[model samples]
Target: MKQDSFSGRATQGSFFEGLFVRSLQASGPFAEELRACGYDPHHPKAIYPIEVWNAALEVAWRRCYTGWTREAAYREMGRQLALGFLQTWMGKVVDMGLTMLGPDRLMARIPSLLALDTFRYELKVQPLGPHQYRVSIRNDPDAKPELIAGLLEAGLGRTGVKPTATVVMHREQDFDIDVTW
Candidate 1:
């Protein structure tokens, strides 16, 4: 079996569990599907496979976000995660520091930022313009591009950039997101 790679406070028994049920409610109806999957947000595992994480998102997409396109629903769920991040003291402190960097710099910092939560991935940001960037994720084809877009939209929005992030490429274990303010 492949080694599990995804981590960070969200995957481990930390901030994510606290915000998960609440985030589910905020994003849509309660996530009864999660419980059915043996994922009790209140007493979550210290670690689980990324496939389970994907399944949880799939549950949210199908059950909670009815009538929405798959990508749209994933994006909305990502935004909810960002909102949850902000409710934490650590996240609040991080946001205060992030506020100084604004969107452009923040986009470039994707790799380092993600390292705090995920692993076994390489992300690069190339500037297409002073206010535009192309973020490429390699080495983990299972990465969710649209969900990343939603995270960017919410995080960059905090800088008042009104940013837009679109998945422009996907081939095997690589994808790119084009981001602009």
Candidate 2:
């Protein structure tokens, strides 16, 4: 089978899939469907085909949140994922760093973290002004602006800054996020 546009390393995919499944399980329903989609939350380093993962997310979201739009659900999932990350050892380190250095410095570290995480896309961080930034993602066909926005918002929130993220551009190849606090 042809792979989907969005693919990540086994470790990255496992982390996300585990978080997604656990979040769904906590809310009740759709956990079985997620597993049926070929993801096992118990295995944290297994490889997942992005196509199956995407389909599973869609199915789980549709079943669990019949009234919510995909964008909204994804945004909320992203937010929860950010919170979930904070619960991990690396996430605790990141949280401590963000708390100490504040959002601007934290923003500067995002690209490195993303690279370390082995995400499918490349991240570029540009400063617009004090307390403002333009974040660009390249080679992202899935257009995950909501997820990016949510993560940024949560990161900023950690630094005691209420952030506002605007999707300046969202296309098949790239996306631009304008973040201000």
Candidate 3:
């Protein structure tokens, strides 16, 4: 038998921000779906399985993004989550004096950050140039490739990188994202 995309683990900080802080932006029906999935945005747990996060992402994508494609919606959700993360105490701690590293260096450190904040979906960033990078994600993949792309964009934007762009080549077992700023 085959497992689904939800067969992994997710962090309370990063993944929940994608749903509660960024996607839903309100209290109501979506809250019930999250509750049914064993998550309550009002009182969240420390870590949730990827299935719960995926459920929350689905509710957000369907509810908050009416006119957008699934991938686009997820990408925006990812972006919002990144932006939201920037405003948190942890984000402040992570960003404390780290901005001097600039976007490229920060991009390379994504693997460690993912390990800390996410349980599933691993990303490896390989620099192709001073301002260009090849990002590949393995393990249990969730959402579209653009979701991570959006995250990179948002993170890069904070580092004073002008015009961060991520182009997804295609969707295989992993996501190949070409990021440049």
Ranking 2 against 3 by lDDT, winner:
2
Off by over 4 Å in 2: 1-14, 26-29, 115-120
Comparing 1 and 2 on TM-score, the stronger one: 1
TM-score each candidate: 0.81, 0.81, 0.83
In TM-score terms, candidate 3 sits at 0.83
In model 3, what is the error at residue 59, expressed in angstroms? 0.3
User: Over 4 Å off in model 1, which ranges?
Assistant: 1-10, 13-15, 26-30, 115-118
lDDT of model 3, residue 21 = 59
lDDT of all predictions: 0.70, 0.68, 0.68
What is the per-residue lDDT of model 1 for residues 1-181, given as tens digits with 9 covering 90 to 100? Answer: 2234444323543335534654655232445556655456655566655655666778778777899999899888777777676666557876886789977778767777654244567888899988899989898746777888888888888887888888999788788999898
For model 1, the run of ten residues with the poorest summed lDDT: 1-10
Better model by lDDT: candidate 1 vs candidate 3? 1
Encode model 3's per-residue lDDT on 1-181: one tens digit a residue.
1123354555564557544755456478877766776667677556766666666678778778988998898788778877776666667677664578787678778777655235556667888886888888775455367777777787777788774556666566576788887
Looking at model 1, residue 111 earns an lDDT score of: 76
lDDT of 2: 0.68
